[model samples]
Target chain A: MRAEALLLFFSFSIGIVTGDWNILSYTTKKRDHHQHHAGISLKNYCESWRINVELNNIRGFDVVPGECVGYIGKYMTSTQYKVDVQRAAEQTTLFLTNNFRLGADGKDAWIFDIDDTLLSTVPYFKKHQHGAVLGCRGATTNSTSMEQWMEERSAPAVEHMLDLYHEIRARGLKIFLISSRREHLRDATIDNLVKVGYLGWTDLILRCAEDCYHAVANYKTEKRRKLIEQGYHLWGIMGDQWCSLVGHPSANRTFKLPNPMKKAL
Target chain B: MRAEALLLFFSFSIGIVTGDWNILSYTTKKRDHHQHHAGISLKNYCESWRINVELNNIRGFDVVPGECVGYIGKYMTSTQYKVDVQRAAEQTTLFLTNNFRLGADGKDAWIFDIDDTLLSTVPYFKKHQHGAVLGCRGATTNSTSMEQWMEERSAPAVEHMLDLYHEIRARGLKIFLISSRREHLRDATIDNLVKVGYLGWTDLILRCAEDCYHAVANYKTEKRRKLIEQGYHLWGIMGDQWCSLVGHPSANRTFKLPNPMKKAL
Candidate 1:
């Protein structure tokens, strides 16, 4: 009896040790899988959706590659709606390039807003359930850490517009990218621009903490003023939001218009 | 008498051939000397001015380190001026870091204009002025032959700014480069930026043929709008021309002002 009891005790101890070791190994595998998934999933999604994918040999506008964060979420649910959005992007590039006589003499410029204009961050908001995904929350003002939430987020770029950008470049005009992303996201933003084939500006402007504005419209107006002062004549302006195009005198011209949707804003 | 005449003619013919050979060698030497002088004269003058000499490092915002171009003529008026520019650049970096709250976490962004803003193009322009200078005025408007002219042109950057750019980057806030240059200059521009310490942008906007505006202000405004759309609250913006600051609501903000001398319209 004594011998049997001793044997049983040893067996139990060995079982416990093995169990623990298995758990540890499982946890490590799980963590690594999560990391790989984050990177691959985002890239895969972008590729599949053809968002930011280059068409033909033309490269999009990007100052830096692989640094900017992109958040993908449903902007509209219906397939018909997506088609509409894509069409709007196509029309916008077309109207701006053709009607405005852009690219003549290489002095024309097109300005674009980043957030909803290029990609949507609504998915991040949905996933994290964080109100105002990119914005500061309550007492936690100016938190750059929020950008980390963008790691697994990305959406497809509007189709057919990359070719339009190429067409514009072929004509000798310029595309200017403007973003309100904090200085921290500069690298990521640039990466996305290049990836998307919108890379064609002589410069890029990002919002810093000091650029506090009463409203988004005011911020856009101020930006327009600066470009005019530099001797670039505005030919086209594009944005998902009205505030991006509002308040600038040039916006009144035919070249400036909201993303064409059947229901105008 | 006939034999004497034939001998004299033969001697005369040989002398003519030898004389032609000497003339050919002399012309080749003269051309080489002119080329050598063009390259060395710039170096010597820059050295005399106490300017930091770097030839290959002239990729981005840095000054090209030679006197072959009119840059040394236009800006390097004297050693005192060179020293003053260097000192001013150092002061600018200091001011940006300490007073402007620059850095990744800071609220200001220094937007640098590539051509004429940070780098001098006078040399490139002058070198391309050859045929035109020789009263071949029609060559200026002829596009087919412009490539030949461009082949001879060499634009050098401002070296001090290149150093300052790197220094500022080390300090942390983003450096947004805005230029009116064409897309073909991208590689050269990026090379220049890297050589001078501008690694890459969080965002880089370039002017392309597709944009609608001909004014820099229009391009700037678009950039500002995008920044706002990205949700970065900007603190400060900087550029060589006033138009670069346009559309930025913070233009009048105390921190947004460029150097007093640079603020001229």
Candidate 2:
């Protein structure tokens, strides 16, 4: 860190944010403990920054560009989430490696939920009520806020799922991004995925206008049924919410990514 | 709140444990985020205190008495763990309330792991390396140490699990305490349970000498099978480790309590 940035960081956290916020920068001097193998990640860095920002109601991170605004949505995931995600992913990979036979027809597929699964809305949620649902009537003064935020095209690929997506594709399996998002927002959603490094998905399926009134689980289960009827085998399904994974014709295996930010919609 | 205690805390964290250990005490001024609602629990209190204790490598908590040595073990569950555990329990309670038929046979049973499920080992593990397995060898020097601690019978009932246990038993069902601890410690273990307000357990099953050589899962699985064969309906099994919950004749449902402290031996 440059001297100026260091001084400003101290100023932002101690003087601007809260004097107690500097405690996060605290570490042990006992150099000999078992080192945490994964060093601090950009996601973790943003999470800490987001916590302080919310606590202080600060507009943005100090000394960083506005582009980093979207990064704060990677909030809520702390060190424990990182461990649990890795464990679940590894188990999925192992289960597939051991049990899922490659299809001779190349029709085997995996389903992934978009928000909080493949991408995050944490940055936007941090600016609003962190756990409030962004439904049509859920927000105040700006119902279009959700649409505007979506247009920012900045929901970053969730770290573990992004890696899992690549590995599934590498294994010559089909991957699909099925979301609860409205179909009209498809273009921006696609652009955001592309910008955020999500690619090679066999397809991106969004909810049609008629499906807006259904429960999220009902809409998602219907989508899963359609995929199966179309002759695609959902060898595995992964989502941060149960709405995406449960109900009839469930995948051969299902992985739930943790999202405790709110009551499930 | 004395200046002397504050100075001692900083010394223990920075000068004794880690030059950077103060990070664990970091909190925000907003004072009101989503208030974590199970309220201030003994384990929760110990966990926050333990984070600072380990980071600073300080043995005693400042402004708190010294004999709370065992309290150091409430170790490293993060904010996420609290959220996840509450969600799962709520889901379980909801599911049971909605679905399970009331059996007049009174033969239905619930299985609970003793440590970290019914009772917390957080206070013990907080002082030791969180992940260091408490193997027989690890216990000998600590063996007398373990015996001493058990005699203190200080292991408090885990807040959430105790609630669930009471609820299950209140419904005219059965609750069993199954643990990986040795048969020799049964007396103290029972004392701890009674003192901590745990009662009406159908049985407290501890590992005998013959079970010592088996993997924990194998031992637990075998015990579960015996219960099944003996005609008890294992409606639900709750545990902190997979070893206790997984493998054969699975319960109608399983509940996993989070314990990131160590890989179970």
Candidate 3:
């Protein structure tokens, strides 16, 4: 591996991910991207993604990934995934319309994060319950299956997000889809989004090889910050991770979709 | 101090001032911001800022205020301060007019660093030969004096940067003056800049108390990124130090005025 990549990856060996020298804190290992819920079982864990599978129709398990959190209780299949996202989207749309002023040009846009926010990765996760750590951070794992799954271009769309996608486009705002997926996945990713009926997007951005070692938040913020610099008003940003929501050039507002499937702290 | 502030200060003590996290490898301690030339005697090393008193039409003995470096050669009269900066400004003007396209609305801007770039603190550094290693990094040493100097706002212009500032503005682009100076000094900084004949800036940003501990590069870059997000195209950024030029949302090109005044390795 390249020296920079080595530094980026192994730097985590230092306990203080907050170590200023290692670059931004890649410090939080298992916690970097997703959260591990209490009772997450293999099927229940979403890894680093947000999944919305209706467990026995109690809505969805609203469960955690990897370890077993528990049997679905009255915990509101009312799942955080199901409840909050829809509300955030509705409120954001209303707020933007009531307050923002866009130029007559139809170029105003909203950004969407691909994996959990737009497409559901549940189907793939079901087929391979191996995305999580085997036991400790020392598991010997192979990603052949996951690569095949990504290459298959077959993830389905989240119903509500699809509705919001169309709603924002109909209002004459452009959509910019940015994903942390490697640049090589560009074709498959585009195919999947199109096959699932996503349209009118101004751009679909996949991470370049150089970005493989970057923190997810740094990578996303840099891109969004660039887009903002280039004269686009990022009306809103929709993502399943907090990393997506917290940085500068903040969207006029943001909507977070629950991706309990992924691990986040 | 706030916990975050302490973290910021302590982090700097790490040799990683060149810490990749900051993107700007703060290689030099006393050298981080400016460089003092060879043969700079204790009396000669007027460290904190650049003082061009013109001792030998070749400029006087330019010395250090912080740590020790080497001696001066034909360096003074050969002061890069006098030659390179002027040439850089002329060349930059040529580059911008030939390559960039400005929006009719006049939102394009060039960011300028206040100290050493727009105004020289040579006046203040002359009195405080005590600006460097006072003992503990805990409390600031000469800030009362530094703050007083700031309040006085008598630092003179770097001359060439000022010319470039007006040139860019005349081309229909706005000017942005951003400094790593503390937030409390905002009024004095502005008053000083104006007192010294610097004007027409769209915004004058000073470091907030909260950001005093941030690495100089990170602080400046974040602000530039925000400006881009707000739809302003940063056409150029000129500062005496590399820290100012190396981050994201790069200006079309940057011009570095020679300020070999502070002590560097």
Candidate 4:
């Protein structure tokens, strides 16, 4: 209540203050622990930044901010990250069970983005400074290293997603695994999926030669468009990237899993 | 490091474990205080839910989850929320000062949402159980109460947005305040804006009889469409709701301020 009062006080004060307006100073004032409230600490601020990133308000970033490396590291490895993923899975499954009605034609399908959505790439990210090096796009040493990492065929399945995969199959929904990973990695990717217990899926779609130059959103949209043309009803599309779920010809519902470590546009 | 290893261990273990899969159990395992991780507490889960909300992943929530009332309360009144707003404003200012070029024509305009974006209706929300009642759309006793609250003309300016408004004005770009508030409240709304130091803006567009039944997004989109028809170049649109920024004929950029109190879609 006191904090609310202080905020209101500050709000009116800023309105009345005559000089050069510095709005941040009023809200960010550091109160002592002995006083009513502590100010916004670096950890608190980074959490806010992460919220912004997840909100898709902050985009087209190559890497996490320099100061937020430790925060991001802790967040990725923390129980919070696990809980977030579980909640996303829960929501998707809840929507599927309660609202979605599969047609008799067997044309009902669900799109799953492979990396971060269906597979755990956090181990590789942990080794690479939690998105500092390997989270970016395009041809560089980072991309080459990422390719080698994919080639190892050792990435684990995203925890709840494997179960969700089985649930989708059991419900007779055709599972289409769409990934931004290039076509050349398809063999290794399949091996990785099989090893990780994603034994059967309708199709594993990867970026081919025709998709090389397009943005991730455009490429994914094209894939969905093709599915639409093929007489498939996309029931749900799940991914860690907004690009996976956005664009025209969207699914009946889209679920976004949390991945603060990387953003692809 | 231990957490990361434990997560990896769980990731692989889930794949190998054969029976009926309850995957959430694997990741959400609660450890002792003496052990490596404490697992996800209730507080942690609510935080994740909040993240999901901000991500636009969770939508159409009627009220803050009953268990999350306290968490949302602390978050709203905390320094963290203020810092989030500040960071949003900072990002907007950075984009404006660095990337945005004002045209010689007066048509280069910016759009601002009224409630939550320009003013703080938190006081009324606090009285109404932090959006338990008033956040819903349509005519009800809650709407009447909310109308009375607005008529008081006592709402405070959202801390950083007023400054952003001034900065936008100083840059010679036309400013349009487009709100979902009915036209009946225009006088009080204008009074509130003036009382809180938002002295000048190009126009204040409010909903009228024709817009009574339209979804907020559609209404705001129509306004933008009309602006475009009038040769307005919407360089930027800033709002607390996604509805304000989305839809056809979008601006060059859209900035979303953090607001967890209410969702109108």
The positional error of residue A101 in candidate 4, measured at the CA in angstroms, is 2.0
Residues A2-87, model 4: lDDT tens digits: 32443354334434533221112222333453121233445555666777777666766777776666667766655556657766
Which 10 consecutive positions of candidate 4 chain B have the poorest summed lDDT? B18-27
- The best-first sequence of candidates by TM-score reads 4, 2, 3, 1
Tens-place lDDT per residue, model 2, B1-265, is 3323423442343223322222344232222331321122233234333322211111211122232223322223332233334435554676578657767777888888887777776566654534334431123344465556666789876645656677788787788887878888999999999887789999998887888777667778888899988888888888766556656767877666555443433
What TM value does model 2 have? 0.54
Q: Give the number of colliding residue pairs in candidate 1.
A: 103
After superposition, the stretches of candidate 2 with alpha carbons farther than 4 Å from their true spots are A1-109, A134-154, A159-164, A182-188, A205-237, A242-258, B1-103, B123-128, B132-156, B159-164, B180-197, B204-236, B242-256
Task: List, residue by residue over B1-265, the lDDT tens digit for candidate 1.
Answer: 4324433543343334321110011111112442312222222323222111110001111222333233333333322222333434533554554555543545445556664445644344444431111010111243334334333334454535555556656666566775655455566667655554456566566666654234556666676677666654454454433345445454312111111111111
Q: After superposition, how far is residue A175 of candidate 4 from its true place, in Å?
A: 2.2
lDDT of 3 by residue, B1-265 (tens): 2323423433342223221111112234232332212221222232112212110001112243334222221122222233334445655776686677878866788888777677876456545542321111111555576677778777877645666677677788888887767778888888878886678889888776776776667778888998988888888887755456655667766655544443211
The 10-residue segment of model 1 chain B with minimum total lDDT is B51-60
| Candidate 2 lDDT by residue in tens digits, A1-265 | 2324423432343333222222233332223331321232233333333322211111211122232333422324343233335445655777678778888998999998887778877677667655435331122334377678988888976655666677788788898888877787899999998886778989998876888777767777888899989999889888765456656767876676655343343
Show model 3 residue runs off by greater than 4 Å. Answer: A1-65, A69-80, A130-143, B1-265
lDDT of 4 at B71: 63
Cα lDDT of model 2 overall? 0.57
Task: Report chain B TM per candidate.
Answer: 0.51, 0.67, 0.66, 0.82
Residue by residue across A177-250, what tens digits does model 3's lDDT show? 98767787788888999998887798988776777666667778888888888888888888765556546667
Number of the top TM-score candidate:
4
Between which residue pairs do clashes occur in model 4? none
